[model samples]
Target chain A: MRIFFYSVQSEWLKTKNSIASWLCLVGGFFIPLLYLIADIKNKTFINSAGTEIWQTHFTRLWMNMSGFLLPMGLILASSLITQVEFKNNSWKQVHVTPQKYSTIFFAKLAVLLGMTLKFFLFFNIGVIIAGTVPCLIFDHSFPKENIPWLYFIEKNARYFIACLPIIALQYLLSLQFKNFVIAVGVGLAGLIGTFIAFRWQYIYLSPFSYTNPFAERSGFSENILLYATIYFVVFTIISFYLYVNKKIKG
Target chain B: MEYCVQTTDLAYTFSNRQQVLDNVSIHVPEQCIYGFLGPNGAGKTTTLKLILGLLRNHQGTIKIFNKPIAGHRVEIMRSVGSLIESPSVYGHLSAKDNLRIFQKVYQCPQGRIDEVLSMTGLANTGTKKAAQFSLGMKQRLGIAIALLHHPALLILDEPTNGLDPNGMVEIREFLKLLNREHGTTILISSHLLTEIDRLATHIGLINKGRILFEGTAEQLKKEKNRETYILYKTSDNQAAAALFARQNIKPALLPDTIKIAATSKENVAGLNRLLVHNGLDVYEITTEKNDLETIFMNLITD
Candidate 1:
């Protein structure tokens, strides 16, 4: 436990100057801000379905982010974290420490997990802040009374859970390759694959589509979580194995 | 001598089936500087990485501080420090922050951050990111990170590589200080004979993934003597030759010189005085210098 804390702390030090972390945070803010501006523009031009604008807007926000930006952001975040190690040639340095190689791997894994969680935080909170502002500025209903808090939490939970396969796959890819482009390339390719899978009505089967808002009806499907968990477990095992066993070139 | 590091019949081959390290064994004595000398691609860095547990799959045995490295690596590495090849620097982090990363991993004292910075001459590099650091500065920071925990053994692979002359000297002096004051056993590798000559108390000359020679510098010098020749330039080359013959010393006579065997220092000095006594005008006496370069070449070629 002590080593784990120290490891995270140490990993944090490695990233203090990295631009990737800031980009993830900015991505969180950027998504909502875009949604807010569009919401304002839409309210001004079109008047209709006045029952619950917040739901439509919130769902839109979730769709774009969970579907496209969040997964992409997670991939970039994992790449950035590993980039600090490989780009700097710190792999040999970190592995040489007295700590166990497995311990070191898990330590890095923890930091990546923290990054994933942090991304989710920014995305979720940005939605609220961005969602609330339009209501205040345009005199639209806040939708606070009808907002299902449990459902909201469940939706975010399901989205995070469903995003597991992608988080694991990208994290594993990032750890395996020293060249940043390969991981990023694989991720971008995976993003495209998700869209193609969407038309086949099997997008939920694709880890990339779990957080995809277009596939929201199937987001909480048991098979989606089960598949996500399976990929998460499998890829995570492969990542740990590679990290602990692969002969790192100095 | 107490060996701080020991490896026996150690070998490694890459996935491509190219042998990176042959059957190799190296013993680094406690508190002594063991220079691992080899040319580029000779597997010096690979060997060090194996010893440091940066890579695991290998054939044979490696023991650190008398403990087998296979299972006891974590415990053994607690007393070991290493810097392999290029300096490991996060270009975005400051020198202080870079040190902090290692300091935290080793669970070193909080004050170690400042202490290592000052020690490595990076104390004033406040918030200056490592990307802005020169190669020399980056190397120093690497050394500082390695030294922060004050390990009993330090394995450095060409630590002074790419440093200016002054920077190299500073690092050489620093390693000497570490050995002298802190009783740190050092195993440093370099292809530069001059650099190793300056700091190494013991040398393991490796070529093509095998140690060609391993011993003290004096032993290498003795190896040097066998192939050395003494050359003498004189006014009376024929007279010097005749005189050398008379004294039962063979002389190779050239147009302007008489070259005699200088098998030993005492013998050379005695022969010079004898030639002077024999009325041979010995204008110049020169002995061939069999320095490390010649010896290293001989070892590799042979």
Candidate 2:
């Protein structure tokens, strides 16, 4: 366990100087900033009374990402994580270490899962700043009373946790294949597939549809979250098993 | 013999049904330079990877430091440093960062990073990422990473593949120094026998996925030197050749000397006595040593 955390810290360092990582960070700030600028410019946002504006904008924010961008974004971020090792030929470097493959595997998976949650936190902060611009600029008051901190955390954290299976799937793809386009291409195809299966009663059966439950409604769906959690557990097990047992070919 | 690494009846087939390694058994003794000499696709790197636990599906046993590699991999690998095939590094990272990655993994002291950087002669490469590094620099960085933890054993596959002659010589000298000063057991592999010929105390030759030979370099030289040839220079080269032909042994007469094929030093001495008794002056009888390249070529062909 000590080695596990240390490996996790080392895994995080891979992204320190990466431009792709910086781009992903900028995305967290950019998405909400774009949405807020558009929302604040609209007359309907100005005419709306009280928490309705926050609710509508927040719903739109999660929906836009949860529908396509967040799923694809999670795919991109996960691919980037494995990309560093794959493109750099660092797999052999890591494997020759005293640390077990299981430790290294979990450390990377945890970091990607952590990044998924991080974007959520930053996205919410972005939303908060941009969402409240009108309240402060036009209404001469902060939207503190209007912003649901608990609700924001609850929803963002829920959606983030719900996206685990996707992250795991991406990690598996990236591990299995060397090229980033194939992983991201498969993910984009899955994102498009989610649109077709999203309204189905059993949407959570698909890993990509986990975010839909959070985005389509105000609260979490017990059945879909339950299903996503089960998938997360299964994906984690299967991916780790394959990673440990599979031969690393040069 | 106390062996640092031993593989018994190991064989492997790829997913595409290409069998890369076939019943290969190689033993590397402790505290010596073991050369894994093989042609391309001769399973040298595959064998190294098996010892490192990078490839798990194989048919036999790999014992490293007296422990079965499958069972005590992490513990066994803790004392091993390896550079398999090409240098494994994050090209996006600076040289220091690459060393730092392994240093953190091995949990070595923080200051050891600088020691390795200076040792590999990359201490002055500030903020220069590995991607921008020259091939030789990357190779040195790989060695630095392998040397970071100060492992008792170092397994390097084709360590001098991309190096210039001077770079190769420097690395050879550096490895010799490491082995001499620190008593580090080095297992290095290469397709070129000359590369290993200069450094290897012990050698294992592989071809077509099987180890053709494994022994000390001197042992190989002794086996290679089995056939003795003496170049006999004489006052009368033709007279010496005719004298040897009288005994039904043909001697190829050159301009100033006659080449005689004899089994042993005693045979050459007897021939010298016989030629001198036949009114011929034996100026010099130089014994020919079979070069390693010839022996290596013969082994591969056989």
Candidate 3:
């Protein structure tokens, strides 16, 4: 367990100047900054009731996030994190370390998961900033409705759960193939396939469809989060198997 | 003798069914520089990879420090450090940062990083990202990383592959000093025999996936010396050849000298005595031994 911790720490150092780190910070604030601009320009919050204002704000935020940004962000983030080793031509170096293949695999996966968590943290903070800036600039009274902190937490947690399978699968692709284009290309194709099949009765069977349906509450079953968890586990297990059993890692 | 690394009948086939190694066995003794000499594509890197456990599902066993590498790979690897092919480094990070990552993995003290940096002559390269490093600098950083944990054995594949003469000399000196001072057993591979010929105490020559020669450097020399020829200049070269012919010993007669196949020093002495007894003054009897390159070429080519 201590060795695994060390592996995770080492893996995190590899991302110091990498694109994945930039993706996390920039991706978090990208949408909220645009929304902030639009709200301030239009005075959208000057006369709204507190509850109505809060509801509208969350709906707009979650709509973009769960529908497009989160999935695509995950696809890019996972690939970027895994490709750091390949880009540096250091896979053989990592493999020759005293750590086991399991340690290296899980440590990298943990860092990817942590990057997603960071993105969400920054996004939530950005959401709050976006909501308050317009009210302050327009000299409007602050919303009287209590911040629905529990609701925000639950929704973010659920969406994060829904995106796990995508993260695992993309990580698998990135680790298995050294080419950056192939991993991201396959991920983009999967996202497009989900949109084309969005209306199908069994579209929920695809892990890519997990985020949009869970957020909109339109097509997927109430057990969609559980299904996402299952897919994540299955993909993770398969990734570990392929990684450990790989004949020529270097 | 106790061995630092030993492999027996190890074989590997690629996914395309190409046999890269066939019944290749190597033994590296403790605290000695075992030079793995081979031409390119002779399975040197593949063999090293299998021994390092980077390649899996091989045909035979690898025992390092007398423990099988199969079940005890991680445990065994704790005492083994390797730099295979190119240096493994993150170009965006400085040499210090690159070593820090491995230090954390190896769980060594922070001070060891500085030790290896200076050991590899990289202590002055502060804040310079590895990408900006020269090939020799990158190679040195790789060696520093390998030595960070103070492993008992270091496996380096062509550590001097793309270096200038000075760079190669520096690496060679560093390795010799490491072996002498720290008792670190080194298994260095190179395609150029001359590169390791002066550095290696023992040698294992590989070609076409088979080990053509495995023994001490002195023994390799002796193998070449077995075909020595004696060229002697006498007062009468013609009579000198005729004197050996009477004893059923054929000598090649030249205008100035007689050349005879040398079986031993005793035989050479007897031939010289025969010349002098035949009223021919034996002036020079020089034994010509084949050079190492010739012997290496002859062994591998055949």
Chain A vs native chain A, TM-score per candidate = 0.86, 0.88, 0.95
Docking class of 2: medium
What docking grade applies to model 3? Answer: medium
For residue A247, model 1's alpha carbon misses the true position, in angstroms, by 2.9
Flag clash pairs in model 1: none
On a 0 to 100 scale, what is the lDDT of residue B157 in model 3? Answer: 95
Report lDDT (CA) for all predictions. 0.81, 0.82, 0.88
lDDT of 2 by residue, A1-250 (tens): 8888878878877877875577567767777877767766772343254556566667677777676677777889888998998888878888878888889898998888777767777888887777666666666555445566677777776787778889888898888888999999998888778777666666556788777634346233656567677888898888888787777634
* Per-residue alpha-carbon lDDT of candidate 3 for residues B29-72, written as tens digits (9 for 90 to 100): 99999999988999999999999888987898889999998888
Give the winner by TM-score: 1 or 2: 1
Worst 10 residues of 1 chain B by lDDT: B254-263
Show where candidate 2 strays beyond 4 Å.
A39-49, A132-140, A144-146, A213-222, B228-289
List the RMSD of every prediction in angstroms.
4.5, 5.2, 5.2
Indicate the worst ten consecutive residues by lDDT in candidate 1 chain A.
A44-53
Q: Model 1: how far is B240 from its true place, Å?
A: 16
lDDT of the structure predicted as candidate 3? 0.88
Q: Give the per-residue lDDT digits (tens) of candidate 1, residues B1-302.
A: 66899998889888888888888899898889999998899889888988987766899789899888888877887788888999998899888888888888898897988987887788999988899999989999899988989899999999997799988998899899989999999999999999999899999988888877788878888877777778888778888788779889999886777767666778777877887987777788887668888788767877
DockQ (model 2, Cα): 0.53
User: Could you give candidate 1's per-residue lDDT for residues A55-101 as a string of tens digits?
Assistant: 55567677777767788888888788888888889888887787886
